[model samples]
Target chain A: MVENRPFLSFLTHLVLIVGVVIVVFPVYLAFVASTHGNGDFLSGLVPLLPGPNLIENYRLMLTEGISTAGAPPLWIMLGNSLVIAIIIAVGKIAISLLSAYAIVFFKFPFRLLAFWIIFITLMLPVEVRIIPTFKVVADLGLLNSYVGLTLPLIASATATFLFRQFFLTIPDELMEAARVDGAGPLKFFRDILLPLSRTNIAALFVILFIYGWVQYLWPLLVTTDSRYYTVVMGIKRLAATADGEPQWHLVMAAVMLAMLPPVLVVIFMQRLFVKGLVETEK
Target chain B: MATINLVDLKKNYGSVPAVKGINLSVKDGELIVLVGPSGCGKSTLLRMVAGLESVTSGRIEIAGRDVVKAEPAERDIAMVFQNYALYPHMTVRQNLEYGLKNRGTPREEIDRRVKEAADILEIGPMLDRKPRQLSGGQRQRVAMGRAIVREPAAFLFDEPLSNLDAKLRVQMRVEIRKLQRRLKTTSLYVTHDQLEAMTLADRLVVMNNGLVEQLGTPTEVYDRPATLFVAGFIGSPPMNLLSLESIAGAPGFEGLNLPDGTDVIGIRPDQLVLDQPTGQNLALAASVELLEPIGGESHLHVRLTGSNQAVILSVPGRPDIAEGAAVTLYARPADLHPFNRESGRRTDTAVANP
Candidate 1:
C-alpha cells in the first residue's frame, strides 16, 4: 500500500488477483457444476458458465434428494445441521462463560488444577477421542438425537480460555465497585461481566457455530437414523456412492447449500467477530 | 454520618506486612487525609476501612458497630477509586443508580438521589453518556456523584484526583474539598501528593513504611513534624536535615542549646534567611548552586562552604543572587527540629505528638 510506483502497483494487483482466483476458482466451479444437468458433467470439462437447469438441479436436491446415495432430502439435513449448530454455539458459550467466570474470580482449592484440566482438553479434541466419545454417547442412549449431535463438542476449552483471558483484562476495580454496590457474584456476572462480553460471545458464537456446522466424524458415527444425519454427514453420504460414479451435479448443489449458513453467519457478524478478536482496549 | 475507628488494624500479604499494626480514629464529619509515598499502606488502610480488604487482625468500628467481618456493602461506606472505576457499559445515570437498585431502594428515592447528585456535581448534562464518552474531569465528577448518591455513612477516596491533569486536579481538589464540607460526611482520603494532602485534609495522617509517622491537623503536622519522615515527606522542597557534626563550627550553632543525642537538625527551607534575624540563630556559610524562581517565590539551592552539604532557601521573590556566590544563611534556633539518629523521632519533646 505504501509503494506507489507503476510497476509495483501493477505487480501487487497481479499477485492479489492470482491469489483470489486460486482460492475462489474451486467454489466458482462448484457453483457452475451445480447449475448443470447431471449428464452434462460427463462431457469431460466443467462448464465455464451457468447452464440451463440451475433451479431444476437445486430443487431436485432439496425435494427428492439422491436415493441412490441413501441420504435424505437436503432441507431436512440443513434443518438438522442448523439445529445442532445453534445448540452447540449457545451451549458452549453459556458453559464457557460460567466456567471462565469461576476460574478467574473464585479462590477455591485446586482452582488452577481445574483450569489446567480444562486447558489440557485443548490438546485432545473430538478427533483424538472420537471412539470413546461415541462409546459414551451410545452408552447414555443419546444416539440418533440432537443431544448426541452437539453434546460431545460442546465443552470447548478454546472458548473457555478465550473468555478467561478476556475476563482477566477487565479491571478489578469494576468488580470491587459492583460488590460495594451490593451486587453478589451472580449478579455481578450477569449485570457487569455478561454485557461487557457481548462482542466476544458473538465472535465465539460464529466460530463455534461453524465448528459445529462442519463436524463430520462424530455425527456420522453417532446417528444411525437419517433424522439425525447432519448436512455435513449427509453431504459425505451423497458423494460416496456404493455402486457407480457419484452425481457431481447433485453433490455440488448440496455443497453450495451446506456452505450457505456459515457464510451468512460470518457475513452478518463479521464486524463484531473481528472486533472481539482484536479490540482489547475496553 | 459515622465515626471510623481502626484498633490495631493489620494486613499481611503472605509474610510481608502491607499495613502493619495501626490505630486511627476518624470523627464524624471529619475529613482525614492519609498522605504518604507509594508502598506506605495508605491505600491499603483506606481499603481496609472500606471493607474491600479482609482485616488480618484488628477491629473496625463504623458508627459504633463492628464491621471488620462485614461486606463492603454492609459497612455502609462508598469509595471512589483512583481510576474513577465507573462502569464502562453503564450510562452515567445508570452508574449512579446501580448501587441504589442493588440495595432495592424505592424507585423514587433512587431517582431523587441521582438527580440531587447530578445537580451538585454539574454532571446533569452527561447523564446519558458512557464513561468513555466523558472527559477525565467529567468522569471524576461522575465517580464522586456515584458515591454521593449512596448516602452512605462515610466516604473513602483512594487518590481520586491523581488521574487528572495538573490544572484539572487543582480544580477538582477544590471541588472535592467544598463537596466534603457541604456533605459533612466522615471521610478517609488517601494520596501521595503532599500538596493535595495539605490542601484538602481537615486532619492529616502522614504515613510512611506501613506506619503513621504523624497524625494531626495540617498546620500542626507542618509546624512540628513528629519524626524525620514527616519532616521530609510533608514539605514541598522538603526540610533540610543537616548533621550536627558538620554544622558544629558554623556561626549559628554557638548559641544553640544542646539536646543530647540530637545528631540531626531539621530546618525548613523558608526559615533560612539571607539577612540575620533577631534572637538566637544558627548561621551557616554556604555558596549558592542554583536559583529556581517559581513565580512568587524562589528556591536557592546552596552548598555549605566547609562541608559542602546542600541546603535550600525559599526566598520571598526573585533575588539577584548568582550561582556559586557565597551567602550566609540564618535560621533561628526555635525553628530547628532536633532528632536522634536511632529513634527517627523528634528529641525536642518526649512525645512527638502535640
Candidate 2:
C-alpha cells in the first residue's frame, strides 16, 4: 500500500523541494544580480552559472572614491554588521544566561513573579512597543549610538526563557555537589553551571546574532544618521527609490552583505543549535 | 576526622514537612548511615548536615563548630551525589583537583592528594579520561576520589552507589567501608537500600516518615529493633509478624507470657524450627503451602491449618516434604517479639526457655 501511493509521495517531496527552493532562490538570485551591473540585472538576465566579471563587479561595488551618492562600500558595511552582530550576540547571551540563572537557581522572594513578568514580554510584539521604546532611548541620550541600537535589542525574552528551560533540566544534585565542593553561588555558577551550559549558550549566540543582524525597523528608527547605520539599515537606505528608480544591483549587493553574518553563524554553529534543542528535551 | 551533631533539625518546603525535627550525633571516625524508603527524608537530613538544605530549626555542629548558618564549604564537608556528579567535561584527575584548586591549595599539595586518591581508588590509570568516557563504576570511583582529596571534617554521601548495578553496588559498598576505615574520617552516608545500610554503617540511623525509628550498631538494629517499623523494614524477605489475640491465652504458652491482649508476633524465618516434640514449645500447626529452593537454602512457606496467615521457615538444604503436607512447627519463645498492634511498638518481654 505504501509503495502504491506513488503520486502522493512524489507530490509531497515535490512540494517540499519547491518550498525550499522558493526560500533560498531569492538569496541565490541576489548573489547573481550582485555579480552584474544594473543594466544586465534590469534586463532580467539571471546568471545560472558563474560569469567572468566577478573581480570587475567587486571593484565597481567597492568604488567609494568616486563619491557615489548611494552605495556604501560592501566590505565596510559587512564589517559593521559583524561588529554589531558580535556585540549584541555576546551581550544578549551573557545577560540572558545571568538572568536565566538567577531566576532558575537563586532563592529570593517574588522570583517566580519576576520570571512570569519577564516572560510575558514575549507575547507583546516589537511594533506595539516601538514608539515608546524609541522615545525612551532618545531621552536617555542613546540615539544614533551603538548603545541605542544594541540596548533595545540585546536583552531578549526568548533567550532568557530558552536558557531558563535549559537550566532547569540540569540535575539539582549536581548543583548540590558543587555547593559541597566549597563553591559559593557565584563560584558555582562560574565553575560548574556556566561551563555545563556551553551548548545552550552556543545555540543562543546564533539565535541572538541572527535576531540582531536581521533587525531593520528598530535600527532604522533609532539611528537617524546614515554613518551609524547597521548593515540591514544600510541596505534599506541604499535600496530606496528616493532620488529615482531603485538601484537594484547596489541594493542586492547591500542585502547580500547584510545576509552574510547570519549565514556564516548558521553554518558554523548548526551542530550547537541542534544539540541545544536536543539537550533542552533532556 | 570530626564529630557532627544534629539537634532538632527540621526542614519544610511550603506546607509539607520533608524532614521532621531530628537529633543525631557522630563520633570522630564513625560512619553513620541514614536509611529509609523514598520520601522518608533520609536524603534531606543528609543534605542538612552538609548545609545544602536550610535548617528550619536546628543546630548543626561539625567538629564542635555550629555550621547551621555556614556555607557548605565553611562546614568542611565533602559529598558524593547519587549520580556521581563527576564534572562531565573534566578528567578524573581534574575532577579530583577542582575543589582544592578553588580553595587555593598549593599545586604540589593538590597533585599529592589527587595522586593519593587515585591510587587509593585503584583508578590511577584512568585519571586522564573524562567522566563521559568512563563506565559507571569508573565515574563512581572518580566521585570517591573527589571526596577523598578534600580531607574535610566529615564526608557525606547521598545515595552514591544507587546508580550502579547490584553486583557493583555490593562491591563498592565494601570498597567504601574499607576506604573510610583506612582514612578514619567521620562520614554520614544516605541510602534507601537496607542491605547497604546494614553492611556499611558503623551505626545505622533508620528513618521513616521523617522520624528516626532506630539508631544503633547494625547487629543491634537487626537483633533488637526498638520499633516495629525498623523490624519490618530491615532484613531480606523481612521479619514475619503475626497478630496474636492474647499473650496469656490459648495462643500463648508456658514459655511465653505473650502479654495479655498482644496483637503481633515477630518471628525471624531462620529462628523458626521445623520439628518440635509433642511438648517442647509453642506449636504453630500449619499446612505446607510451598517450598522454594534458592541454592543452599530452602524457604518453606506454610499456611496454619486453621489460620489464614502463613508462616515461612528458611532452612539450610532441602526438607523431605512436599506441598500440601500438614505439619506443626515450633519456635523457642526467645525467638519471638510481641509488638503493640495499635502503636506498632515492640513490647519488651523476657525470653523463657521451654
Candidate 3:
C-alpha cells in the first residue's frame, strides 16, 4: 500500500479479488440455488445461474411453506425473528446505558464490587448458564413466549462495559456544569449523556440485533410451539425434514430471507457503527 | 446581586484536608479573584462555595442564606469551567438555555435571557451551532452566555480562560471584567495567573497551601505583600529575598539601620537602579551575569561581588551593559522590605496584617 510498484499493485488487487470471491461465492450460490425449481438438482449438481422458479419458490416458502417439513410458514417465522431481535437489541441498550451510567457516576458502598460482578458475568455466556436459566424461565411459565426468547439474552456485559468505558471518557467538568445548570441526575442523563451516546447505541444496536436475529440454540430449547419458531430454527427444520429429501430451493430461499434483516441493519447503521466503535466525540 | 460569605469553610478527602477552615466574605457585585499555584485549594474553595464539593466543616451563605447542605442547583449559582464544558451535542442557544429551562423559567423568559446573553457575548450568530463547530474563544463565549442566562445570584469561574491562547486570554479577561462590571454580579474567579489576577480582580485573595496568604486590592497587595508567600507569588519575576549574611559587610552595610531579627530583605527587581544614588541606600558592587532585553524593559541578572549573591535589576530600555561587565546596583532604605526568617512575617509591622 505504501509503494507505487506496478507489480505490487496488481498483486494487492489480485489478493483482494480472490478474497472477495471466497467470501461472496457461497451467498451467490445460495441465491442461484433459491431461484431454481425442485427438479433442478436431479443431476446432483447445483445450478450456478438464475432459474425460472425464483418468485414461485419464494412465494411458496413465505406463504404455505414446505408442509412436509412440519414447520410454520416463513412469514410467521420472519415476523417472530424481527420482534425478538428488536426487543433484545433495545432492551440490551437501555439496560446497558442505565447500568453504565450508575456505575460511572455514582459512589456508594461496594460500587466497584458491583461493577466487577457485572464484569465477571462476561465469562458466563448464555450457553454456560443455559440450564439454570432454562429452569427459571420454565418455573415462571415463560416457555414459547417472546419474553423467554429475549430476556435471558438481554443482560449484555460487553455492551455495558463498552458504555461504561465511553461514559468515563466524558469530562467530569460536564457533569459539574450540568449540576450547576440545575439539571438533576436523571435529567442530565437524558439530555446530555443519551444524546452524546447516539453513535455508540447505534453501533451496539446493530451488533445486538444480529445477535438476536441469528439465535438458534436458545430459541430451539425455549420454544416448542410453531407459533414461536424463529427464521433460523425454521431454516434448520426446512433442511432437516424428517421424511424424504429436503427441498433445496425452499431451504435456500429461507436462508436468504433469514440473512436479509441483519445485512440490512449493518448496511443502514454502518457509518454510525464505525464511528461509535472507532471514535470518541467528546 | 448578592454577597457570598464563607464561614470557616473546610474540605477533607478522607484524612487529607484539601481546604482548611477559612472564613471570607464577598461583597455584593464584587469580583474577587482567588489566585494561587496548582493544588493550593483555590478551585476546591470555589467548588465548595458553588456546592459542587461538600464542606468538611463550615458554613456558606449566598445572599445571607445558609447553603452548606444545598445541592449545587439549589445554591442558585452558575460556574464557567476551565475547559468551557459546553455541551457538544447541543446548539449554543440550547447550552445557554439549559439552566434556565431546568429552573422552569418560562419559554419567553428563557428566550429573552438567551438573546440578551448572546448579544452581550457577541455569540448570537453561533447560537445554532454545536460546541465542536465553534473555535475555542467562541465556545468560551457560549459558556459565559450559559452562566449569564442563568441569572444566578453569583458567578463562579474556575480558571475559565486557562484553555485560551495567550492573546485570546487577555482579550477574554478584559471582556470578563467588562461583563462583570456591566452586570453588577457578585463573582468569584479562580486562576493561577498572577497577571490575570492583577488585571481582573476587584479584590485579590492570594492563597497558598489551603490558606489565604493575603487579601487586598490588587495595588495594595502588589505594593505590600503580607507574607513571604504573597511576596513571591504575586510578582512577575517575584521579589528577590536576599539573606543578611549575603549582603553583610558590603559597602553600604555600615550606614543603614534595619529592624531587629530582620534576617532577610525583599526588594522589587525594578527598585534596584543603575544610576548614582542621592538618598540613604545600600549600594552593592556587582557584575552582570546575563542581560535579557524583553522589549521596553530589560532584566539585568547580576551577582554581587562582595558575597557572590545573585540579584536581578529591571532597567528602563536596553543599556550598553554586556554580560560579565562590572556594575553597581543601588536600593534605597524605604524600598527594602525587612522580614524575619523564622516567622516568615514582615519585620516592619508590629503585628501581622490579616
Determine the iRMS, in angstroms, of model 2.
Answer: 2.6
Best by DockQ: 3
Question: Mind giving the per-residue lDDT tens digits that candidate 3 earns over B1-354?
Answer: 999999988899999998888789999999999999999999999999988898899999999999999999999899999999989999888888888888889999988998899899988888899889999999999999888988889999999999999999999999999999999999999999999999999999999889988889998888887788888888877898899988886667777788898899889999889986896778888999999999999999999897888888789999999899999888888788888889887877733346
For model 3, the docking class works out as high
**TM-score for candidate 3:** 0.98
TM-score (all chains, Cα) for each model = 0.97, 0.91, 0.98
Task: Output the better candidate (1/2) by DockQ.
Answer: 1
Residue-level lDDT of model 1, residues B62-176, one tens digit each, is 9999999899999999999999889998999999999999999999999999999999999999999989999999999999999999999999999999899999999999999
Error of 3 at A154 (Å): 0.4
Give stretches of model 1 more than 4 Å off.
A1-3, B350-354
Candidate 2 residues lying further than 4 Å off, grouped into runs, are A1-24, A41-53, A65-71, A242-244, A279-282, B14-18, B246-252, B259-263, B277-279, B349-354
Judging by DockQ, tell me the better candidate of 1 and 3.
Answer: 3
TM-scores of the first chain across all predictions? Answer: 0.97, 0.86, 0.98
Q: Which ten residues in a row have the lowest lDDT in candidate 2 chain A?
A: A62-71
